[model samples]
Target: MKFFRNQIENKKDKSKKEDLAGASASASENYHSLLECLHHTGELKSQSLVINQLKFMLIYLETMADPEKIQKLILPALHKCMSLADLDECISSAGSVKTQSTREAADLLLEGYCLITVDTCSEFWLLQVRADIHRPPLEPENEKVVRGSHIGFVEDMAVNLRMIRQRMANKKLVFRYLTKGKETNTKIVLAYVKGIADEQVAETIYRKTEKIGADMIFSPGFMQEFMEEHPYSPFPQFLQTERPDRVMANLMEGKVAILAEGSPTTIVMPVTFFSFFQSPDDYNSRFLPGAFYRILRLISFVIALVLPSVYIAVIAFHFEVVPSDLVIPLKTSVSGIPFPPLLEAFIMVFTIELIREAGIRLPTPIGQTIGIVGGLIIGDAVVRAGLISNMMIIVIALTTVSSFSIPSVEMSASLRLLTFPLMILSSVFGFLGIMFGLMFIMIHLCKLHTFQSPYLEPVAPFTKTQYKDTFLRFPIRKQHKDKASEAGGNKANK
Candidate 1:
């Protein structure tokens, strides 16, 4: 208890920043001082001077949460007598992963989770309660590539941060934890390559991030929403991936990654458009196979986005271009069906969506069984009963399969929801309507910026050198397998 007191009396030079006391006390007075200052709230530009009012102190320390673990242990205020606290046990019981004592003495036994107290009774209790929650780890739902790492990001922040830290060997891979959400005190990590990441980008993150004052920064998705520069764009300007490999790749490219404490996925900023369609396996696998997968993903994206609208165009307005032989088969299938081509398409689309939603919301085993039965019984029974044409069934199936082909599940889901409007447009202006809609979407994408970089980087800006890693996975080194081994994965692809 006396150790901290001695250090405070003799150690501080009073020149550089000191842990200035809020009061000059008898050292016996009962007072509260905020401890283990994990974060700063209220104001960024506040004065650093300490105010001594009566017997109280509100000392602010750089290291807040677990104060005992701090490396430099010159506690000049340790001489005050108190009982030794089982602080670690209490904190762990409080459900935190690890807890460190903020101060040395037990009687003056106190650390500021919010405020630590001295000369007080033992009734001082801990503040802040965090419920551990996050999304489950699953395969990358949207950006699935066969050759990549299988695990996806879960909602737990610590777990997610660990995933990022595990990959990089460089100490320059830095993480700074900041607390936000005035009530929630939600933790967020700012990550970057100290040397590789642009200095301005880190500063920009710090500036914008500190301004956030939500009641509860509970979700990574929610935090990302508040912190990002643009809010209304239809296209995602940042790359939000659960895959650590993808994060490592972005780190290598000098991009910043932000992980909120509760969200399963972290977000990478200043993402180029070409980066969104990419998968980690594109760089991990052989170049030729990687290129093949990239082309497949690109094709799938194009199909998911435009196929139905194209179908509506051809069937409604370009039927004259259809060969006579195929037309008879199509006519025969729809012979008893009373609806127009557009109306029939709508009905089919609506039915498939209902089944998909049901499949996803239900439990896994039940959902799988339901999906099988729903697809077989519903589609086959309806066709057999002559309610809808066989050709209509085929179109809906193609759309569903193509929609799943997208790598990021969120993107796929977005594509699915967007298809209905495009379908309607196709019925109105045929291919021209689809073209108009697509052009508008593209403009939104190009206008979007992730962490100040062109969302469509390497494309909007047309960087030929950057393409060495985009779409096509080039070798780690042009010559020598030893160089490939030395460089780890393909540096160009990064």
Candidate 2:
């Protein structure tokens, strides 16, 4: 029995030595391949070092790596190191890792990690030395608010994630990283609460992100177009916001947020038509005031979308609906205009759009000056010249104000565009045309699905329980109780 045991132990030792020899050979081949792959790039830099008579090579990209950290933290630690184990202990960065694959080492080098290769070791070390350069989290210009946290997302994904984690420290909040864009290789993060967010929804988002085949994805808009169910729809399927608080609020309500590197905007999915009208200021104020402003916004949506069309229809085909007292004055104001109501409407709307675009493209001070000069001077000159009617001016100005009141920029722009089609319909067919246009819009809203979630939720599906928070803000305690009761009912049913 002792002789057989000794023979077995010898065989095991020989097998172990053979495996070690194979690994060392593979590592040597991989090291050379990694160097050859990166040699063509101008930013690829390398240095050789001798530690206790052992040869070592350091490789990294100069544009992406931190020179200060390599000089102060990495080089000094390497000078004191005697072996691979000492190298690990001397540099204490948390992002250190070991790999034996050449492809993985090349990827790490491009991602701002320093690769350390030793002549006698079978694996290489990767140390995080990414450059820290980003703008401070200032308030986003387009999404500014009056009564809430002023912090907004920056272009850096790490800083954005840190801000989110700082706000909500719950363990349930989870993030999954994905890399898309064949050429750009942009990094995207999917964030959701583990239990609160639906598992199926998360899975769907993952599948869609994995299937994105674009070569360049520089902004959130690119991903939005690819992932949205209906790319041609005028209404935005995903809500884009730069506010971390807004993201946190949606995460708590079982929605997913898609954040991309190098973009400050975040895309929130499974949003409803009502989501575009909500503002953080609504929740920051008293519930009654919040509800009032929310309802006002919804009213503005109708006014902005259909008000100009209503005016055109009335003036062109159904002048009998006008009040008797104001009819004469309206006719008098419009009598001298040579163009028909349709052409008059087009001219003014087109002019307003031009002014709006100019204001956006120019610098802040110049844009403001252009808007004031264009609105006051051009509007008065056109009216005195009898090119446009006084009543039409009033209607167009009111429509512009209402469109501006919408909280979402995408939704506001959609409304502005939808206005023209409705105006054309009303001009041709009167009140009947306006009604038909509205019906078509309503049908589209009902049929639209964002990741299988109804776009017109709580209205088309007719959920009375969700009505408390849809068009109006309910009290916090009441809303929570309702949600808890609904959750309990769902669990019991299941």
Candidate 3:
């Protein structure tokens, strides 16, 4: 209450200061006579008309005011009126009437839409301005993979649209632009194939985007929370790809893509679970390594999400399930640990998350050093100090490693967040909790949709032909032109 009162007093002091400032500003002498001097207003008292209507008056007026004294005086806002009046007219003609403030007065003195009044001749100025401020093009940090195309999304929306369009040569590929931000006029574009993509998906993208009412939106990530299909779900409902080729592929898959002006990344909508796992490099790189890497990523994703919880559940309640040989090792590792297995696991996992978050927020070199030094110092010290068991450290390290394996940064973030609740669930019900959580996850995955397509498509639908790309990648010829494709079964990129 004391702090609150102080805060209120501070606000009152600020208001009084503002009021004093306003009073000081308004206390200045009225420059009405000086303002009148800006124009030769003959109607005002003490008017010193400068421009002569007659040649005789010009010389006489020059003499009336001392020539040396008049020479020192200057009119600041003086502007020559540009008007078309008939030279042949004797005081009147059809088009000779001066169009002053009514028709075209705004153009005088390089005015910005404000009308310039010079005895009332108006000139309308055409005013148009584009954004002058722009962030320099930089490689997308979110979607970095060693072997993939180095060209990532930049802040320029037009450049992003061109990158995706260059890959998708189909004339049916449509890019629709809309103006957002009431004051900023931020340009946002939605790109998709006209016929190849589903019409409903395009509508959904536009509808969701139109509803975004933010004071400012910097990245596609800004729109994610407001426009997501499931607000409460941890999984990313949209797939944001830096690679244009990846976006083009999603377009072919009947999904809609959104590109924000001044944002380098393009958001592909109705993204499936497989879309996050798949990458442009997967299609571009050597098939065997690519397929193996993709499979490993899926495995790691599961491990990242479940490893800690499994360790806790097993150690806390399911010890009978462990082999006798392994039991001694586990017992020895956790022997001196004071906390329960569940609490120990939580401590390690939470600490790892804290380190990861810090690393992400820190500068590149510093962040890398922190990740390395922090991991080594903390893990070694904690285990040696007997604050946490070695097994707990291993489980946390593995979980962190698995979290990093998923290709999509956003998807990995979603998976990482889910680890905590799952950990808690496992702590209480053991394997039953694991089974229930997995079932819930599966149900949620089945229910989630991006645009209009099921997020767990091909897998949920159980398409034999589609799994060729999901579980493993079939060679291009086999996927595109082989006998199987000709048999009207394969439609991987179509």
Candidate 4:
């Protein structure tokens, strides 16, 4: 209780300080007001420089402001200037120079821009000197492709935008920027192709994005949760990817992408259920091979979501479905097992999930070792100890492999999570329960929408034209033989 009281007292003290700072900031006298507002902030820096007999004060955030740019370019050029006109002429090459009010100046300072103030000047110039700190674009670990460009989006928004623009030279591509988060003030960019993109969808996304007023937004996921229509749904509506090429492709398909300043992943909006199943390899490989793998992935999705449940249902309640040839072996395998199918399935599934999660969180070499031990050693020991049957182990292994085949990490996770409920339902009602669960998921997918675009596009509404590239990849162009050449009909030109 004393600790709680102390915490409350500390918060009250902070609030009082903020109120005092706010009151002091509004009382004009520019320089004093700025200093008072920045009080208690240790990173606030002020430098005094003289240029041609005129005294000036430059204020900025030390951590965000670039020292080399300030000392080498700004100060040296300003030292030779005689007046505001000369100052403007000298610093014309410096990008984004503007005169701002006190509030705007304060915001600029925090963004790494130096606020330049003369002794008697009422307004101050805000110069861009923000530090460039970002990781170089590296191939995404999860979205790897063998034949396509490996470069992926970095945390830097400007660099990510440049990567897209570098590949797509179309002038119609547009970027609409908005600032979200009250405390963080994170920069977000909504990118789309002008004529090709659905204007209504773009407008809806922009409106919803602008409406976000969170105190802090750290990632694309934050924006997604805040604005997605069905936030409670396990399946992700917006497709997130780190590849700039993927963003460009989606833009061409009339989809919009949302990029957050500090996030490496960007979200493509109005995506279909099939969109998450696609990979860069689909376009890079031959059409037949691509379509084959695409169909295989779809099958994998079904298998991942229902195979274990089907096994449980059949063994527990519908053992007659088993073929006579395999029934003896199946019976022998389960005869030694002590627990019922439901409990046995749950235990093994939970163990697989635990191992998979630990493998991800641990370092790579150790993770691989753990996977080998858990999958081989632990699994073998459990079967020998009669805790689980060999057939159950096979079902779990196939389920794990199938889930890993999904291209999107979010989609894969959702499929894995849905497995538990389906398993429970199937254990209760056998094949009937599995059918009911599938029906509900289908209905949910049909009802889901992103920015008013159907979630199950080309399937629910059934557009045949999109099928050329949806489940299959068709060649971009094919030459047609001229009938005139074959039949010799055009004699006039000859």
Candidate 5:
């Protein structure tokens, strides 16, 4: 009986040893497979360590994972870890996840997570140690405002989301994450306020974003182009801004904001024509000043779009429309020029565009110097050579200044583009041509829809309630009262 008991106990111990051996072998195989699949990239790093008498491996991408974090947090935790439960307790990372599949573990490793493999354990522990790689959120040069929060969005998605959260501490603010770009696997976040944002609009944006089949989405512009309703339209369907306050304001108004990883620009959807003209400075100032500047910007838009065309029409066909006193001066200015008014305008406009392009491409101080010196030299030389008229130069300069007055760069660019068609029409058919071009533009604006919202809005669809905040901003107190009354009326109707 005693001999039989001893043999049975030995068999049981042998079985236990076999089970441990199998687990160890399986873990080792998985680790080797993961390494093979990840390939031998320069940034890929692996460290072997002995923890609590068990063989362990730490694998991560040096470019994506923070080395200091692994040293300070992960190494100490591993030393204290006697078992998986101890690891869970001792590791400081809140985003640690466990996976047994080699493929899943490899994916985690690429995403800046530190992967821990224990020789006798099938599961791999993923620790969040992503590198903090982004610049400080300094105010964007293009989106500068005279008054308001100077903070702007950074390239880091996590930091951008935190900025939004810090500004608007509302529970209703929701974020939906989606991955796009098969090759890039870029992270995208759709942010909107619940109950305020139209569910259909949000869903439309999400569906369009998810359906994109591109292999690489590097910037917000790429996503914007893919999701825009009117891809061919010169006007931007989405409002891209770097300011957090601007994004917050749009969110409050039931607009959706799309943020992409690795881009500082945020794309706001369903914006109207007036939205592009709006500046944070408008709201920061008193209602009167805000309204004045807003109206001025609108006027600037018209001038930027039609000023050159109007000049061409007047010079080529409608000399009578010019004030009798100024007609002589206009005639005198163009009399000595060799080119026709149309050619003259084109030359000056093209010259301005060249200077503008050069200025943008060069360093800041040098750019300003180039713009000023180049403009003066070129304008004087053209006028002296009689290739471009003095009057045409003045007109083109005014048009350029007017275009710059518009707050939105996209809209400003659109205006610059529209100028060419109108200039051609005005040169051939005079005022009638200008009128036809304006009519077509208005028709396009009215027909254009951004996510089913009228592009013109409040004006074309004629919403009386929205007028308070449209072209002319009413006093904040009065606007609030109107909103309250409007809400009350809505409730009563409901």
Candidate 6:
């Protein structure tokens, strides 16, 4: 019985070898056909070499393939080689592969691999000769921190993933890659903790990204507009950050991060409205200072969004709300203004926006000068010209400062944007219009969802457990033991 089993196993092995040989033959034929298909392209380079009287065809893309490697490294090694097997053995000095599928071989060529096809052998070899050219990782201009890792992500996806892996060093950290953009073939990586991340949320995000059919995906911000639940909404659903520490922190909390090649910024998903308000600087400091700054940022959010509107409402129709003592000066300041409250407010706000934008677009040294000189000159000139009131200037200046206090630039910009509509409404109907605008914003926040997780989060759905980390940071020892729960996976309402 043992002899019979041995004989049957030998036959199976023989059959497997035969099948592999047949497949290789077909692959070689298909590879020739693929070469013919690409023959018309001017960059398709080919060279012939004879080793032990056997003719071999070497093919590569001229633009991407390294000529130095082919001449200095590859040819010297292949000179004495007679067969594909020997060639493979010699090329072990560098990364090379023997592939059978023609489609795969073509793909390898695109990736800067040199293909060697021997006339006598069915299997072909692909040699790696990719030239890497990219800028070194530098501190991101937008996400500078007072304390923490100064190294930020560069445009290279491999380097970004390496940095992240070095920090995490966890087996559960899974990075699933996908190629979007039909024309650009842009690569995107979705990273999450396998067991910690909510499976449903991750799967939904994966499906949405996979379903994207755009012709080109340029950057992380460009891709974000497509993946967000509400493109029409001013608020950003995903938090964008250049800090790998922030990305790793979010991953530990079971949130998924999307990283696109050619983009330094990465997107963190299933974020709450509060997520943008929090910054890496917060955790870098002591609990007391971090919590205090966190609270201050939240207050800034309110002040930035409503300060101008409140000013408009009070001066236009709700003057009784102001203290009687200050009313005289306020009235005197506005009495000389040539326009109504809304028009005056709009002129000052528009001028500020223009100055801010110009300052940003100018060079740093020039931008500071522009911001200081332009602001002082414009503010003083407008006040003297009676085009805008001194009180309105103060209100607008406060509003700008409050908006600037928010850590996230996108959120700060959105807050600034909401100011305009509220100002308009408050100008017409005073307090009632302001209330309506607030209600509309609240309803919009409640209706918004990120990966099916509520945007308003603990506040709207009333999840008491999450309050520990919401508005305030609790003591470190008071954190929940189940780290995944902090992700708010189950606590969140759809």
Give per-residue CA lDDT, model 3, range 1-494, as digits (tens): 99999999998986564333311111011113122222433322222333323110011111123333222221221212123232113223221222322212211111112111122212211111112344544456777656656677677776777677777778898888876665455778888888877787678778878988887777776788888768988888877777776777788877888888667777878778888888777877888978898899899998998888888898888899889889999989988899988888878877888888899999999999999999999999998899999988888888888888788888888988888888889999998898899899999889887666787888987866577788777776666664466456446655
Which regions of candidate 6 are displaced past 4 Å? 1-58, 67-73, 92-95, 100-103, 118-124, 480-494
Q: Arrange candidates by lDDT, descending.
A: 2, 5, 4, 6, 3, 1
Locate the minimum summed-lDDT window of 10 residues in model 3. Answer: 54-63
TM value for model 4:
0.89
TM-score of every candidate relative to the true structure = 0.70, 0.90, 0.73, 0.89, 0.93, 0.85
Model 6, 1-494: lDDT tens per residue?
99999999998986564334321443345445556545557776788877777677778888879899788877887887866557667767547787675656766787788887776577768888765667888778888889888889999898999999999999999999999999778899999999989999999999989999999998777888778778999898889999899999999988999998888889999899999878788788887888898899999899989989899899989899889899899989989777988988888889989999999999999999999999999999988888889899999999999899887999998998999999999999999999999999999999998887899988989877777677987666666653456557657853
Clashing pairs in model 2, backbone N/Cα/C closer than 3 A: none
Q: Spell out the clash pairs found in candidate 3.
A: 100-120, 100-121, 100-122, 104-122, 104-123, 105-122, 105-123, 107-123, 154-264, 270-450
Model 1 C-alpha lDDT versus the unseen true structure? 0.64
Candidate 6: C-alpha lDDT: 0.84
Name the candidate that leads on TM-score. Answer: 5
Q: Score each candidate by Cα lDDT.
A: 0.64, 0.88, 0.66, 0.85, 0.88, 0.84
Off by over 4 Å in 1: 1-156, 478-494
- 422-444, model 2: which lDDT tens digit per residue? 99999999999999999999999
lDDT for predicted candidate 3 compared with the true structure: 0.66
What TM-score quantifies how close candidate 3 is to the native fold?
0.73
Q: Write the per-residue lDDT of candidate 1 for residues 415-439, one digit (tens) a residue.
A: 7777888888889998889989899
lDDT by residue (tens digit), candidate 4, 1-494:
99999999998997675454421211234556676566648787788877777777778889999999898867877877878667667666646556545566777788888777776555576778999998979999899998889999999999999999999999999999999999899999999999989999999999999999899989888888888889899898989999998999999989999999999999999998999999989888887888888888999999999999999999989999999999999999999788988899889889998998899899999998998887898898998798999999999999999999999999999999999899999999999999999999999999988788888888888865566666766654421133234335446556
478 Cα displacement, candidate 1 (Å): 4.4
| Clash counts for the predictions, in order | 36, 0, 10, 0, 0, 0
- Candidate 5 backbone collisions, by pair: none
What residue runs in model 4 are displaced by over 4 Å at the alpha carbon?
1-32, 94-96, 478-494
